[model samples]
Target: MTSIALITGASGGIGRGLARQLSAQGLRVAAVGRDVDRLADVEATLRIVADTTTPEGAALALETCVRELGAAPTQLAHCVGTTLIAPLHRTRPDVYRELIRVNLDSAVYMLQAWLAALKGAPGSAVFASSVVARIGVANHEAIAAAKGGVEALVRSAAATYAAQGVRINAVAPGMTETPMTAGLLNLPAVREGAGRQYPLGGVQTADQVADVLNWLLGDGASRLTGQIIAVDGGFTTVRPLVK
Candidate 1:
């Protein structure tokens, strides 16, 4: 049987990059997203339009991929998330809920759907997390809370399915150059300040993060599970205090 890969939020920077790389590797890639037009631009064998944040939508996307690809996806990459920069007290309830829905809830639903479709077959899943989820980043309470839940879910689900041959992992990246962070990085001052926080002294690109994620979903990472790999430029682990 042919191996298939499914990527959610495929229209986004990281997702699009991942889809292209995976497709280049000759795995039948199913790119799932809400935008039909944008998805068409992705290098995927199948472009599926679905929310994947809702249970029904997630299920539908997986089912559609299995039907179209002639096999369940052996690899899953969930790049669906949103960012928010606001302190808790000042954060509105609706905004928090939306962040949770898009960032955390989407991962939960998509993972569940992926596992259900696998039906005991071995597979792997990788999720997009944030460095803020690991450290205390002021004005990022809402986004932190949402991504924190995602990290927790990753660990718990990884433990739950490891014995069944399913591996789950996440990558918590520092400020990345994606559309979600465009507004912050568009300003030269803000971009330089953000880059300085990382010990590596630069913002990561979507393709850079996607490279790590691709490994997590492949056979090389077969022994890895329940691990949150930080793709940040030592922002989470090092103190680049000297500026």
Candidate 2:
């Protein structure tokens, strides 16, 4: 039987890249997202349009995967997240709450809803974490906090599910070229400054991150779990020059 992968937020950006990559690797892809039209464009073996931001939506998405794909997914990729980049004091309560719900709660709900399936099938769950989860950045209070929770969630789930033949891991990316980073890249100075900060002197691509994720979900990374792999083009390890 062909392996199956359920990728949340699969309508765009990194999520879409992962969907395409996994599908190309002969895995059945269940593309999940709130945007039905966009999700339909993913060209996957299956498509599930459910807003992962809500509990009901998450359940429905998993149900679709089980019904159409013939089993629980052999790989789960939780890529549903949002960011509100603003200083703590300037950030509104609603923004923080929404960020937490989208970035942290969605992953929790998806995992809970699919845990039995995952255990029965024995697969990998990969969360798309951010480098900001580890490093502090200006005007990123809400997003950073939510992503930190994601890192904690990955480690906790990995430990909890290891005995069940499941592996949980996260990929922390930095300055990737995606629609999410378009605004920052639009500004010439911001783009150049961001690039210079990376030791590789360039930004990472969504495809590069997708490649790592594909490997993690495959047997090549069978022994890996509870690890946060950085795909930041050396940004996480390099220190900025202080002049």
Q: In candidate 2, how many Å is residue 74 off?
A: 1.1
Model 1, position 157, has a per-residue lDDT of 95
Model 2 clash pairs?
none
Q: Write the per-residue lDDT of candidate 2 for residues 144-237, one digit (tens) a residue.
A: 9898999999999889889888999999988888888899888999989888888777778888998898889889999999999988877778
The window of 10 residues in a row where model 2 has the poorest summed lDDT is: 113-122
Tens digits of per-residue lDDT, candidate 1, 1-243, equal: 668999999999899999989988888899999989988789999999999889999999999998988889989999999898878999988988899999988999999999999999999999999999999999999999899999999999999999989999999988899887898899999999998888888899999999999999998988999999999989888888773
lDDT of 1: 0.92
Clashes of each: 0, 0
The TM-scores of all predictions, comma-separated, are: 0.98, 0.96
Pick the lDDT winner.
1
What RMSD value applies to candidate 1?
1.0
Overlapping backbone residue pairs in candidate 1 total 0
